[model samples]
Target chain A: MKREQGAARGLAQRMGIPGPMGGAHMELNGNREAVVEGCGGILEYSEESVRVRTGKLAVRFVGRGLRIKCLAADSLVVEGFFTGIEFLW
Target chain B: MLAGLARWLLGSVTFSVFPQGGRRGAGERFFSLAARSGASLWGVRRRGEAFSASVRAGQYAGLRAPARRAGVRLRVSRRNGLPFWLRACRRRKGLVAGGALAAALLLWMPSCIWSVNVAGVSGPQAQELLAQAELLGLFPGVPRGDIDPDLLQQSLMRRYPDAGWISVNTRGSVATITLSERVETPPVKESGRYYNVKAARAGQVVSIHATEGEAAVSPGDAVAEGQLLISGVWEDVYGASHLSHAAGEVLARTQRTAEAEVPLRQTIREPTGETVERRSLRVFSLQFPLTAVPAPQEGYSCTARVETLSFGGVSLPVSLYIERWEGFQEREVVLTEEEAAAQAWREIQAQTDAWEGVELLRAEERAAVQGGVYRLQVQYTGLENIAVESEIFTGGGDEMTGDSNVG
Candidate 1:
């Protein structure tokens, strides 16, 4: 399965496809807020941290005053003073 | 900010969720279900076992299934935004009607011309100009867009030939007409025509200087009013008549008499140190009195000033009327004989100074007191120029003779 996925990704890149990994995409706006597109669902939420499930990994946001400003079907907005973003596969 | 505005325009509802059924990770499950159902949420807050958020009003009903499956109960605590306001307005028809009327009036007021102002003109000519403007379809209550300023100016110039220059300017709802009348210069007569230099006033001729024509009087001559001082006609050695306009100066001593009087005993007013002020407002032609204080019975002097409202260089009918009163008491004043005499002399001196064609070279004053009043008389004597221009009649003759030495 891993080899097949790697081959598929290589094919997508050759075909000029963008974000073809079927995983979440993170966009940071001035380190004050972040928008995560293609997120699966929320796993944990707190004032200082928010953990969400992406396709093949878990994305964690560590920050101060962290809160989910917006949550939609395919995207979520996080607002705070962000310290770091980490992915656990 | 755009996102917030979008939410406001689309209408948003806030609801609180309380976790129940002792479910593990109920808050996370609730979010997962809401995301799966494609519902958007914003301004999420969590405290202990309760969570709150806002969602679009259309998505609020569908949120219940997700909240129930996640073992959380939802309660919509607040409803706001434009959708709610419109819903409330639908029930109150009078408010909506009044709002519509006010909006209509505001839009219509500035489109109609409220006043026509005519500047740089006055008197009968101004009235005629305004009448012409009215005939040209420019007047109060006419729609502003229907009047063309350039066309109006062209028409005015055509209608009033005497207008040297004319212009029309419109500002807001007021139209202003600026114009100037033609200035005509009098024609100058040919020097060959005959004219007599006459005495402008009754005076003793102190000196005579003739630049043209023949002198009719000598130095120290007494000339009566309208008397000819220079002759505009002369005869050659062969007895042939000649004609010309006379020009000369005749200086003379003129006398003027002036008299004044003052009373020895007079009535004066002393201020009682009391004052009152009253103000009122006028709208259109209706007067509304605003003061509550009663009128004072004591002697008082009242002064009033009315200030009208002006907008865009045009005065409106509304005005503020203000009246101020100063109270005073009557007192009898007795003047000494010398004081009364001096007062009478001062009054006569003022009148003598104002006399035309004369200066106060000398004055004689006489005063007598009768019935507590002074009777005064004065005579002022001074030297003055007494030359005037008088056109000589031709009498249909090419040669004219004039009277000489008429002083």
Candidate 2:
């Protein structure tokens, strides 16, 4: 019971706390990210399943199921339909 | 329409790919697709100046949490496969247009009633005429396309008898009314004969009127049956001999009084309503024929007519009519004073109306009652004199001509 309480406290402190790795990064407006396949990243990604920091967004054929808390970068993760996604100036 | 979509598709490429945001650009395009969609495809043409210029705006209502789900963006037409926006703000023209619109909004709205209107024609008191016309509950800003011009003209004409012409027109936010006045014509001068009206039965004249020809008797005149009480022939003391083929005059009354009796030798009237409905049909140029029509069944007589045929608006090769008459009862009619007065007036009308042989000029009636029996006298002028002058007054007699309204 004591060990579980210590782990939870550590997780709360680390909420949205960026690791000291990226170069001068600023918080985005809380929008979701979708990464392209075959791109260099610190996470596994595809058109359906994605890992953002430690949070995972995956859509399967059946019921609601999840594998979360896994991601890195400012890219978006998409699932259902696609053609062109955004305009970057 | 396909070409338009192609152009937009080509244009969207530029706005799609730069500084990509959450892949939401895909979502925004989907929303726009939904908004501007239908079985009807839209095509735009820019010939010389564009027909319309508008600031396009759209919204995406698909998401409940819009803050969390940013609307997707579209790829725009850009150079060398880049996001559509220009590298730098290049021109101030768009800003200038916006600023001008803002300034105009701050200034006065340039709209007002430029003028009051009258329709069909204008009268002497045009302003007053418009006021009277407005009483019909019509006003400016009423769409001309929606109104029936003839009906509106008729309504306005009724209120302004003096007007000859009236028109309505609108420009921008103002409406204008225009009008012209009617020309007046003097009545014809009548110089003709008069006939004496004897009493058909004892009764007082309820009314006496002289429209054009001379009146031989006045209202409230009481005379014995067959006595000369009303006359149409009037003479000047000089007694200069004057001639008139068919001079103007027509008169009638609503009532006269007389006593009626049984076995007093009443008029059988042939038990037939002898009404002649004459119709003419054109066979060719300047030719008219009275043709035969279908006969009626037994117990009835028909005055069948066949004129010229009509094809569309033009007269055709033939025209005809079919008439049938049924039996009518000729029962004894016991007339009171009111009936006698009415019958006397009706005779006066018969004397002063249009006729085939001699022109009707003036009519007068006299009445007397005795022993529950009424007697009546009907006298008419021009009935004898018009026969003396044939070919003096003969024409097509269409209403378009000045002599059209002759009685």
Best by DockQ: 1
Candidate 2, residues A1-89, lDDT tens digits: the string is: 86885576567558965432221222222234233322122222233333222213222211122111211122222333333232111
Reference-based lDDT, each prediction: 0.82, 0.37
Using lDDT as the measure, which candidate wins?
1
For model 2 chain A, give the 10-residue run with minimal summed lDDT: A61-70
Output the lDDT of residue B148, model 2.
49
Q: What number of backbone clashes does candidate 1 have, counting pairs of residues 3 or more apart or in separate chains?
A: 0
Error of 2 at B352 (Å): 40
Please give the TM-score that candidate 1 achieves against the real structure. Answer: 0.55
TM-score of 2: 0.21
Model 1: DockQ score: 0.53
The DockQ for candidate 2, computed on C-alphas, is 0.01
Off by over 4 Å in 2: A1-89, B1-5, B9-124, B143-148, B165-178, B186-407
Model 1: docking quality category: medium
**Fraction of native Cα contacts reproduced by each candidate:** 0.69, 0.00
Off by over 4 Å in 1: A1-12, A15-21, B89-198, B201-204, B208-217, B222-249, B253-280, B284-355, B358-384, B388-407
